[model samples]
Target: MFKTLSRKTVYQNRWMKLHEDIIERPGGIEGLFGVVEKPDFSAIIAVDNGHIHLVEQYRYPIGQRSLELPMGGWPEQPDADPLALARGELQEETGYVAEHIEQIGYHHVDNGGGTMGCNVFFATGLTFSGRNPDPEEADLEPMTLPLTEFERRIKDGEILDACTIACYGLAKLKGLV
Candidate 1:
């Protein structure tokens, strides 16, 4: 195991913190590691009948728009309840609220580089109300598609968000889809 000798914040913002660490390997060799510290997030698979709701938004970092599951973290409330976050994200992004929601899985975003984990939720019995998106998500678009079409989009490399793909796969294996 690598032991952290010292760590310093290289940068910090409301949403994330970047840390540079000095680590000692088992053989007594010292090396540097960079880690991104972020609040835990939630991803929602909002399903109704045979369709799934997803959101498309422009990801500035990637310089493109992405179609993915409704997911987000409350940076100001890092320790917020995962279930609540999932439900809120689904409604905020898709304008649909679920009558039932449950956690299907949990996983780290990037074990090698980040301290962010995601709670995957399976939601059903949805009701359409209206969206209340954050200002940053002003361009977000919501859509509902058949599960098979979603799979096809992933297979075609059109859906590239790791969290969305992993969460859906886990939900599928657990018969939540």
Candidate 2:
């Protein structure tokens, strides 16, 4: 088994922290590892009458806007419940409140580099309510399209968000879609 000989925080901010660790493997081999520590998040696949709800927002890191499934985490409340987070994100980003929301799967975001995972949710029976996005999501735009078109966009390279694709795949595989 690998062992951590020493660890230190390399960087930190309100959303995440980076940690550097010196580790030892079997046979005395040693190396350094860098890990990003972030709060777990939720991804919601909101479906209504053969259509899917998506949010388009400017992703600062990519320097462009992306169309993705409603998803987010409450960094300030790191210990928030996943169900509540999923419900909140759905309404906050897409302005669609789900009459039914249930967790379908859970998986790591980036097992090699980040200590973060997501709870994938399947939401249906939606009702429209005006969005109340956070300041960071000031540029958020919500849209709904047929499920077949959503899949086509993914194939056409228009929807590039990993979490969105993965969550949709999981829900589909589980026959929730």
Candidate 3:
């Protein structure tokens, strides 16, 4: 077991923080662990008329366009419900709201570096509207693709976002797709 000795904040921003912790490992070795963090939240895998709703955005860190599911973090409003967050993100990122939203599961994105878990949802029966994307997310735009094309992109390694891919895969395995 790893026992924490001390924890100190190393960085802080609007969305998340970084912490450095001194810990004693199971083998009796004492070391430091750097952690990046945010409040846990949910993402939605929405499908409508045989097409999946996705978002295309330029990730500045990677300097490339990426495709991903509708996702968001509500750290500042931690008390807000996960279901509401899911619906809000679906609308904000995809400009679509689902008439049926079902909780699928939760995923730990990076257990080694963070405790941030994303709640996964399967949504259907969508209605489109104008998007109200956050200013910080100005580079994002919603796109729709057929299921076969979406799967092909995954197989080709074009869709690189792990959380989005994992959630969709799980949904398919569970016959929700």
Model 1 C-alpha RMSD to native: 0.8
- Runs in model 3 with CA error above 4 Å? none
- Kindly report the root-mean-square deviation of model 2 from the true structure over all alpha carbons: 0.8
Question: Candidates' TM-scores?
Answer: 0.98, 0.98, 0.95
How much lDDT does candidate 3 score? 0.91
Taking the tens digit of each residue's C-alpha lDDT, what string does model 1 give over 7-101?
A: 99999999999999999999999999999999999999889989999999999999999999999999889999999999889988999989999
- Stretches of candidate 2 off by over 4 Å are none
TM-score of 1: 0.98
